[model samples]
Target: MGRKQSFTATELLDTTKRLVLEHGYDGFHLKLLSEHLPGARSTIYQYYSNKEEIVAACMKHVIVTVLEQASAVDETDAMSALQQLLLIYVGESQLHQLLGDAYKINTANSPAAANDLEFVEQAHLTLKSQLTRLFERAQQDKKLRNDIPLPVLVGVFFNLINTPNMLNIPTPQWSELLFQMWIGGARS
Candidate 1:
């Protein structure tokens, strides 16, 4: 009989990210993940075929989690929706790191790498579509500037999450100032 399941897919993915950060994708393996997680190597194999499959799964998890959180915001308030999504990105620094890793590894000429890129690209499209919809709504209500194209406005909204943190400013103050600057500039 198979061993009882001891870890969840989320737990496995979380461990995978940590291990990837520590050892990098080339150096990671299911054995390492198994040791860090509460399961045997076979248990990990039950869910994934190999390192690439697991990595792809992990990236997909990040994409889905972010999209779900972003989608939960009230659509009636475009600014609030954008701000909430940005706030989530600000809070989850690790998500960007994982995405960076995915981008770095995606150039490899392998099916797994292609799959990884597919997940990242899908995430990008999903975010763009969601933000574009919100921006359109805001524009129809005359809450946003009419001069900028809808795609550009959507790009600006998503760009808010990439605000640099080199100065080590606290997030609350950082987000507040960022939002103020965005609203001040983008408002009609």
Candidate 2:
């Protein structure tokens, strides 16, 4: 039988995600990725043809995870669901920054990369729809203030993902604190 692979796809993708977030799409390169991985540089090629493919695959992997977790959230209590969803989004906050560089990826030569980007786009729409649904439900249930426009509230909620965790608190508590601040305001 052929020799076993030194690293799994998840490991490679996870490393790719970290590097991309650290270096950005413009700074990220296959050479840098190989430096952090366990196997030889050629091994990366075996998994992905080029940087575009790898980065696109990494983006797709992240959004897919967020999509899964967001979908699993129960909507019976819209406000509760929004809190949980915020936690999920905060956990993968890097995804928002990563997706911002998606347009820089040239998919002309790589169908796999193109397909992965397409999935990312579709998954983004799905997540947006879910968030909108929850917000509307919450507003209808009178859980949220009716004065502010839904889009404004939704925009602010989404912006919370970018809030700096200056204290480096754990994700669970950080998310909870944010949700509370969003609902209860900063005033004592």
Candidate 3:
């Protein structure tokens, strides 16, 4: 009887994430991945052509999942949406760390760097658009300051949004403090 295959794209991503955490991106090669993946080298290669492609695919998969889930937030107001998003942001922060090693690989090599940047930009823009709407609502409701330019406000929020994950420091009040800062400044 033929053995059932447990590997999948999802499995690939999960494995990739673990490898990134354990081995770092530079340590994630076919020879290393084969040990953890429980599959043939060709199997890994069948799904991914090379290490760069593998990192790109994994990063894209994670960001896409996050954006899709985050975009569905049903909060009625800016503060609520911000709260909802902060919750999600906190969750995503840990996930992003999986890409830390991949990020080093991305930052070093120009050949594959552009693709990683593109995927990250897509994720960034996705969050930016959602925030823009929330900011507009807050402006109309007098919940946020309107004097600041929309792009600048969004940029500030973006900076705060990435802080926890980038530093690997999970402050219990991180999101709360960030939301307060933005809301304090966003209200008109």
Candidate 4:
């Protein structure tokens, strides 16, 4: 076989993620990917039509995992809890990068993402629900001013946290940078 998938889809994603981390997205191309995994181009295509879909799958997998981890953080100080959540999404230990680049790519090109968009939107709604709860708690506890609505906070918070690469900041700076703005909503 010219293409060898020594790894399963999970393994292929892990390898793809590692390759992306090591070489960036441009370095991970369809030809190169199929070459690394043996069988045929069609085999890899069976799992993902393009390299973009593979990247999207890897990201969606991580995001779903992160939300699950944060599910147990039911505290009045949800923003404080977010500091910890931020670690999973943005910290050095982060698996696929803060918000998953391939997911963003698919979303930005939503017509192509139609297959997974419903599931993705549902997942986002769930995360937003969690954030909404946190904001509600914050307002009740008076840690966050009550003027801002939960839906708005959810939108703004997600947009800020989901800014992909911050472009120039050092790796250590991401969580603090994100939280500073996250905590900004609480200002009276």
- Indicate which candidate wins on TM-score: 2
Query: Which digits, one per residue and each the tens of the lDDT, describe model 2 over residues 7-115?
Result: 8889999999999999999999999998998767999988899999999999999999999999999989999999999999999998888999999999999999999
Instruction: Give stretches of model 3 more than 4 Å off.
Output: 1-6, 95-120, 145-188
Total backbone collisions for each predicted model: 0, 0, 7, 6
The positional error of residue 48 in candidate 2, measured at the CA in angstroms, is: 0.7
TM-scores, each model vs. reference = 0.70, 0.95, 0.66, 0.57
How many pairs of residues in model 3 come into backbone collision?
A: 7
Higher-TM-score candidate among 1 and 4? Answer: 1
**Candidate 2 or 1, higher TM-score:** 2
lDDT tens per residue, model 4, 1-188: 35354447886776666666666666767777666665666777667777667766766666667668777665546678766666555643445352344544545544444545455557767866776677787778887768877677666655655566646676447767777867774667
**TM-score between candidate 4 and the true structure:** 0.57
**Candidate 1 lDDT, tens digit per residue, 82-185?**
67766776666567667666745544545765776697788868877887787788888898888988877666655776778767889867776777777797
- Cα miss at 50, model 3 (Å)? 1.0
Report how far off residue 70 is in candidate 1 (Å). Answer: 1.8
* Candidate 4 residue 6 C-alpha distance from true site, Å: 0.9
| Model 3 accuracy (lDDT, Cα) | 0.71
In Å, residue 167's CA in model 2 sits off its true spot by: 2.9
